[model samples]
Target: MNPALRLPAAAVRTAGAVSPRLGAAVAMPMFAHVAKPRPVSDDDAPTMSLARGRTIRIPGIDRRGVDVAVYEWGRGPRTVVLSHGWLGRASQFSALVRELVAEGCRVVAFDAPAHGGSGGRRTYLPDWLATYAELQQRYGGFDAMVGHSFGGLATLVATAGEVEAARAVTIAAPADVDELFRGFQRMLGHSDAVSAGLRERFAARYFPGDPDPFSWLSTVRRPLPAGAPLLVVHDEGDRVVPFGESGRIAAANPGAAVLPTTGLGHNRILAADVVLDAVVEFVTAEVARHPVSPTTEAAAPLTSRAEPVGVS
Candidate 1:
């Protein structure tokens, strides 16, 4: 723990001692909060400038509408959808965008509500999932879906349902909601009771009338679409999300491939040429083998040029 964050962590523990629900209340805001949104970097500017920008308003959190900022590149029939992580904008995918476009693929990416040029201040997983649903409807599905960190989980959740794509990719993504909740609990130094209460509130708010909210949110429980090939790109030295998470994701879905890199940490992995190349090659393999069309019906199995091995 950072020396600076210890005092606040202690305060959360004290609050939990007072009442579990109250402690949960204290942590919910931060857990659901989106930190300061990252602006487009200088390296990302040229690609972002080339994207045709637009907004699409959808039903959002807290009983409001969220105007999602959507960005697109290329006009090819082979479409790829990009999802940026929490506190990240679509611009983080600049390098990958250029690669996909150069291969004759159309790319669509969005700033989830409250991130980038979108609407609102706070956002959650449901909002991210909703954005995916909305974009899929408008664009008539995709050839591949790529997401980083939080967005990686979102892409997984999207594949579990109706968001049809020929292939999927996740970069440094957590495997389950429980790991994320536990990490948050550790950060706040909250008790088990507080953790339970937080889930209680989370379920009631986002998944009312549903039992086992976490089941719907877990990638293991609802593995990726059966036929679609999945590439789990994770850095061996990632600090933000554990490297082994990709292992979990791969295990849950048989035939998934792993692309392990070094020294990229969490965020830097997004800008790495190796990562971009692997992702583009994996994402476009379906197109090279078959047509760009991705139907709900089963298609040919996904085969990737990347090795299916992991880091030690």
Candidate 2:
């Protein structure tokens, strides 16, 4: 009886009254609508007074004219990019931003297509990765990357040759795309025929030529690059993305450090001081461990001293 599950279930029931094919068609669009996060308003987000930042637009997936919104903060020697989860805005990192700046690390966060200040009515995982890759091209490699939930999956994907980062931290992230799809099917109570049909449409639309989109997009199937340090944090009470997802990532990568928390759930984990402290400590330690090379040391800084612009 979760509120989020109710709408999709109703839609499935309506569609099933017609035919399995019709049910699948109706369920697919409903799934997409629910999957693409709704935008978050400024009033609901934390105060953005401490950090200086600006927003930039980048082309979205398929070069479809949609623009992704990115916000950059701080001007420290080491840079860390943050990826917020589905339905989350860049400003959700307000607490972490303050801490990262205090520790002397520049921070960059973006609103994935159709979320926050980004342009679009619908979006998918490809759209998120596209926006992330664009930002990496604009700003160069990062010292570390931190992501939450869906963003966490994207961050893991980026480490696999898309972007160069010495370290990564993922909070409440799912490790397998197959598990995600299964969860979606359960939420909507779709029949096997309807689920298979939806999967076919999904594969055709997002991953043509790929025999199995589920395995192709799975973090567990395609593990993180060898020797790339990672920290996996998940809350025991996280009902959205199961904590076992984080466990899978940790088990798959022996080098990954797992930190389990209690009571914070999914969203609240982002604001918890203990989580922020762990992240700051890990990132700062990694930065210290890998000092900037003399050749790149002289390069101009990515941030400016001028007044920071507030991203809507």
**TM-score for every candidate vs. truth?**
0.89, 0.84
Question: Compared with the true structure, what per-residue lDDT tens digits does model 2 show for residues 33-140?
Answer: 624455444643544544454455544434445766677677888889999877787888888888898898888887776787777766666665666567767767
Q: Name the 10 consecutive residues with the lowest summed lDDT in model 1.
A: 303-312
TM-score of 1: 0.89
Query: What does the lDDT come to for candidate 1?
Result: 0.78
How much does candidate 2 score in TM-score? 0.84
Each candidate: what lDDT? 0.78, 0.71
lDDT of 2: 0.71
Clashes of each: 0, 0
